[model samples]
Target: MTTTTSGPPAAVRSVSPRATVRLLGAWHTTGPAYAALADALRSAVLAGSLPVLTRLPSERELARALGVSRATTSAAYARLRDLGFATSRVGSGTVAALPRDASRHEVAAPPPAGDAPASDTPSADPTTPAADDTIDMSQATPSASRALHGAYTRALEALPAYLDGGGYAHLGVEPLRAAVAARYTARGVPTDPDQILVTTGAQQAIALLATTLVARTEHVVVESPTYVHALEAMRRTGARVVGVPVGDVEAIESVVRRTGARFVYLVPDFHNPTGRSLSADERRALADLVARHDVTVVGDETLTDVDLVGAGVPAPVVGDGTDPRLVAVGSASKSFWGGLRVGWVRADPQLVRRLAHTRQVLDVATPVLEQLAVTDLLEHRAAILPDRLAALRAQRDDLVDLLHERLPAWDVPRPDGGLCLWVGVGRPVGRALAAAAVTEGLRVSPGPLFTPDGSGQDRVRLTYTRPAGQYEPVVDRLRRAWERVGGR
Candidate 1:
């Protein structure tokens, strides 16, 4: 006799309600514990689960809930504050602040049904990916925890003595400047400490340079499909950006001559997105053209060290000492950890001084702790290079192989170095593909994101920086999405 003893229909057996605070599944435990917590929260906010003005639990409550100490919660909140994600008043508990784009939300919605077959005619939703889409090969960043944390830890231990002062200045701590100069000196460019200006990151350095050098309506030459953020920076300064195809020295020269541009931004080593490096001849021609046109050259060498194929290319020489127009940008973010936020600009002493002054007004100074940490990494550079290079090479190879196997129709060029491969999808399906990828729980930077003029509609930049395990799943998704979109 099955006794129906339920008073309210056995209380209607149901699955447990999902947690309001969903921790990011992809977060790797590294760096500071507080940082991990902050990143998890940030991801949630970015993903739109935690909407703006949502009241977060108290520190004690969160600590207990997350199984962490209250101090950890406090530190995590502090990090959130630093990143502009939360705010606290004297009496009110911490509340969620909107991201830069306050109106954006990441509310979970059901994925769109598989779309119909792809045609040469463009779809209404250009960013939708096909149903069988597997890999999201769009981001261009290194995988987390490349073992540089050990170097950073060692660096931190040696930093106590240097923390004697108030630690606020725009020129950066002297030791870090010296260390950066030494790196350039080792790399064939003889640089002095005076010629180095420490910045928060390569992005900040680019912004400062743009602010100081670019005037409203002045023309700036950028490589087609150049670093998107850099292009944005140029636009922020109200500069007219003209794209010269990467590896086309003549095209760049013609633009420089025609526009009489004040500056030209070039990525000589493993150019972003495309991963094409300028040949020795092209670099020389670029330098000569800039010199003849009296235009400043901002050489971004952020991806200089991730060389996976053949002998590493030589750094571009911007002519003799008298040339005050060449500025080289370097960063520890790509080769090391992005959290370090330490980058330097190598230029003439006068120009460096000017940039330093501009930096003073903008950020006052980069944190001394991070600067010291990067300085230590630079001093022990030999110990870290081999591991970094090996990890990146493995990732690049894994991605390339996966793409070939699953995405045979996609034209994925094998990059010689850097963390990303620029893939051509044979048609202008990038927007559709990106939108579709997001529905499949993948986020990607569509090709048009990199182009200033919304061109490159057929290309996508895929990062090989995720874990090896992620490659197959991503590719599988891409394959499924492609098939659903009727891969030609």
Candidate 2:
């Protein structure tokens, strides 16, 4: 009886088991299933779970483990290889690799030394650094106008006769010059068409001024945290730039008196990066000091029209009639659009002629199309300006609210006008924070980019031109980076 029972049990146990098939989820079975899987893997890699050079699972093993078709797994692996995220060998299977993005290497590298030369220097190649999405807060520019198309169209219609004339005159279109002069008059600086000389942009205006005024090794006074590019331009002309502290009238006056500087470069209207406007008394004092010292004041009013806050603030160029030493520079680039590329220097007629003659050696003249476009916008200023001011104001408020909510540690002064907020990081981590931000797909203009001699390492200028939706992510990323750098 025991033998019979044992025999039956052995036969039943020896019977072969049936093969079973398992189904994969829709993500694995779809036409682009491999792409979906590769994306998932990419997310994992970006999250730092799988570090660079780590070996990935074998295609066959992964397919079996995930219950997916071998072809699907192979395709996913191939996709990763193509993206430079993985590499495969006949015997070694696949291994994670560094991302093909050039910026990845930059992020991984140590922060640059504080005194490193600017990337824009003539000898320096900007393209050498693997191109990353750079958030350039160095410049203060406004967004394009909705009415630009109409303005440009009108300009094109008026361009035929203008084109027929000899195009090599260094002075810009007479009408645009008149328009610029009219703007100066409207702003309380009385001027004639003969007083304005249009240039390629504010940059060109600065370059021309610097070249014309500064003799080799001449002393040029600039605010301590002035626009770096302007400082560079002045320096390029062999001018010894003297930094004068802003916000305090006495500091600037003291520097002016002490240096006997030939020229003073200033941004009086909601001063760039700092957002501090000089009081009327301060402006009067500055004008008096410049007049007394015979220092030619080159007033950069690029941000003059971008009055988002402090709407009642007085103009910075109300010169005392005694001196007539002020050469005010205004640009449509910031008030309207950068693509307009139209700017004018408001000065005495003789000085304008000199600048025009100097400009002939550089750019023959400002583009006819740009000049006309700007003229049209200036003509319709009443209709277009209110909307622009309103939009900019809203953007400024939105950015301030976002900073307050997400990055309470950051001390951002709400600027009266201008497109950016000069933020105080309270520590010299601008470079480190910027490096960390790149890893998270954020580009920030470190404060040193604005300072002469690569100072201001504890600050960064943040623009509000980005719409509210775009602005939020930037703030979040910056907050994360700030936290990583132990920001206060």
Candidate 3:
């Protein structure tokens, strides 16, 4: 894996057959091999164990791995595709997904506010103990601000003037771009409209950058337990992803040095799942490292707007002029809503021009109305910020306190701003807990889902994005799941 050749290496995604067999542990065997296999695999996908968009092992490979006929593996995949749980693209083989959505092309909407889709929140808990009402603690997208309606209403008043045109602006409507740029300026980054290129959402923005920048076998740095979809985006680049502990400057710089990595991805503001912000000192040290190594840092500031506990998140790490290679990705998803599907990348004008061409292929342009709505939302953000902050803090505190009571063994952190808590369950039973969570009618993400190499088996990310009342039941269900998995 270390050796690098002249041109780009042949791009392919491969999963160990043994890993598949392990994921399918104790699968239902009463029926024919294919049917039982499909059902068991479906269970894993729904349980948040096997991520959506995971490449299924080859039929022959899986057949050998599971000691079944190749036809059984083939039939299972066919069934998955038929059930809409998988898809086959020309280059990508049969890929795992949830049943409802079939498009492997579009960025599935920020994994249901937090829970990665396909690997979903609606999926069953493995504990087999059903709650009165299913609670999805996987993804915690904030409910849209009360200001959204008025903003959009105002946007409509402003819409028709632009409606006179074909409604296709490759780089997004100028007003929205200006509004987003202004946002950066307010944040101390002093961004210009030309520096911002809006996309349907952060997912597409990430894909655009990955497609434009990453090459086969190139080393890409990621936080060990970061957003799952971001990890997937980097993997799509066909790069070797190196995971470093959050806030560990030395570890990150060492990888960049060793691998000669040019790109590094980070979520410095109220980091996803963990909800921790980088200290000013840490950010400065990291910025210096990227500047020295000449690495282009891609920072996800999607959750930057939602500062609940006031971690006093520092300025954008790859600040505008200090490191020209830095690209900032922000979203309307966390602060406002994922349904808005508005996100932007702040980069150099020349790069933005190149990305616009790359982005048009992903989605010709973000929907006109949504861009207006986002622009409107930003204009009214000050009116909405305080309440949103209050709601998030209340939920975060409640979730942290409850876990301490019910799952006392888990070392759940008190995240100041982000939507979720990355809980250390004190045992390496995250997979089993995730599987059991399905039966408990609670959707939760296991530790491996957040790991670059899928090794964090003792951790689970719990989002406080659900209703406050739901936390009690979530705790109850998690306790049941823990007990079911021998967590006594």
Candidate 4:
């Protein structure tokens, strides 16, 4: 009964008839057809079985799927709209929503500081647990590395050199850009400083790319369950955002060929949520595919350096960023600290120039000190990674083992690298569990937050960024929440 509706802009996600019918079990109670359908839909939304913001099937589609009269569906939809459980848009069709009076505060108030999804940048307010006992599993980030202080201190000592200038580093400081370019070159992708344009963070780099490259009505492709904020950035560009399954190169090419999409975004190395890294063959295939299609492929390597296993990572997907179509974006957040707020685009110099120009309207420059700090981190990256990777690996293993022992029904796969574990809880109760978790002094992201389409209802992403000792409590809270949501 999980919903399969895609998210905004393109509005392509819709609940399949089969899913809708399954959700409406014994919906035809002792009541009118329309009332029964409306009640059932409402109950599903309230129960979190049918997540808010997903598109429901059309009246005709639902009628055919459920073997009901079209009039019954039409009336049911009308009732849903009237009850504020759904909204019908001109092009977007019926989207699931919540009425103001839905009493969702059971999951809303006393907002958890870590309730926000994974991001490398710091929030205006410092993040803290929702309560004294709350275990926040919402964000997939570790505390700042100890080496960050030294980097910032060095940056401070170096700050006077730039104070004499106008300080408008629209293209970022030279040293940091060169450092980023050097890091790529070390990884077997030869890059130049001119080809790198630094931004406030990786999120800004994405926003800048979307603004510069994605034209209105042009198509953009992302993995089905992608980084949510990246999806939001693409949708904001007014582009038709479509999704292919993660690591599905053929599916990506097919969608591009069919839709004439101009941009394809990927997290090829240590992808967030699923933590799947592309093999060397897959990377080569994607590089060739983008070249053949003459479409721009944005490879987000924000999590690239977070290799938990000593096994070396593959080279950059763009293969030196010589192709104007292959853009590689990276960040200092995962390796050093999110507070530094530094990211960059390694692209063709022409695209870098264009992104820099586009970035002015949104944010003119990254902070000078942050850029300097990140440069220091990059220069000393070899010294910084071992401990970070060790901690992350230990946490990942502990969490996986704990989940297997405590919630045996949940499928917890061990990924070689990455900060989060995308788990299958063996039930379509993710949203319900998240809501219940809040009451159990836990904050978590439901699987729906990771995807444009609502197909991952039986899934949830658990971050292993916290200490190994903290995981037992996290699993305990999750177990309590799972049971509350009817999971065995």
Residues 1-488 of candidate 2 have per-residue lDDT tens digits of 00112211110000000110111123342457788877666543432223333345666766777777888778887887777666654443465554555223222223244322222111333332344654544445666999999999999999887777877547788889889878777767667788788999998999889988889877777775777779889989988775554555554555455456678888888887787778888888877777677878888988887777546456546473235588888888877899888888887778878888888777788889889999999989888888898888888888888888887777778888887877766555566667556544466667656644344555677878875556776776677556545454
What's the CA RMSD of model 1 in angstroms? 22.6
lDDT of the structure predicted as candidate 4: 0.79
lDDT of each: 0.70, 0.68, 0.76, 0.79
Q: In model 3, state the lDDT of residue 106.
A: 18
lDDT of 3 by residue, 1-488 (tens): 01123322222233458867887898757788899998777655544345454567777988998888888888898887777666666555666655553223112223223232232233643434446566788886778788888878888898889977998989999999999989888878888899999998999888888878888889888876788899999898899887766766765776676568888888998888677778889888887887799888888999888887665677887664445688889899988888999999999898899899987766699989999999988888888789888888888888888888777767888877888888877655676677667766778888778877544566788888765666888888888667656665
Worst 10 residues of 2 by lDDT: 11-20
Write the candidate numbers in order of decreasing lDDT: 4, 3, 1, 2
Greater TM-score among 1 and 3 belongs to 3
Highest lDDT model number: 4
Worst 10 residues of 4 by lDDT: 116-125
Q: Which runs of model 3 end up more than 4 angstroms from their true locations?
A: 1-132, 320-322
Q: Model 3 clash tally?
A: 13
Which candidate number has the best TM-score? Answer: 4
Q: Per-residue alpha-carbon lDDT of model 1 for 187-247, expressed as tens digits?
A: 6777788888889999999998999999998988787678988999999999977665567
Ranking of candidates on TM-score, top first: 4, 3, 1, 2
Error of 3 at 217 (Å): 1.9
Q: Compose the digit string of candidate 4's lDDT tens values, residues 59-132.
A: 89999988889999999999988887787766667877667654331232223334432221213333333568
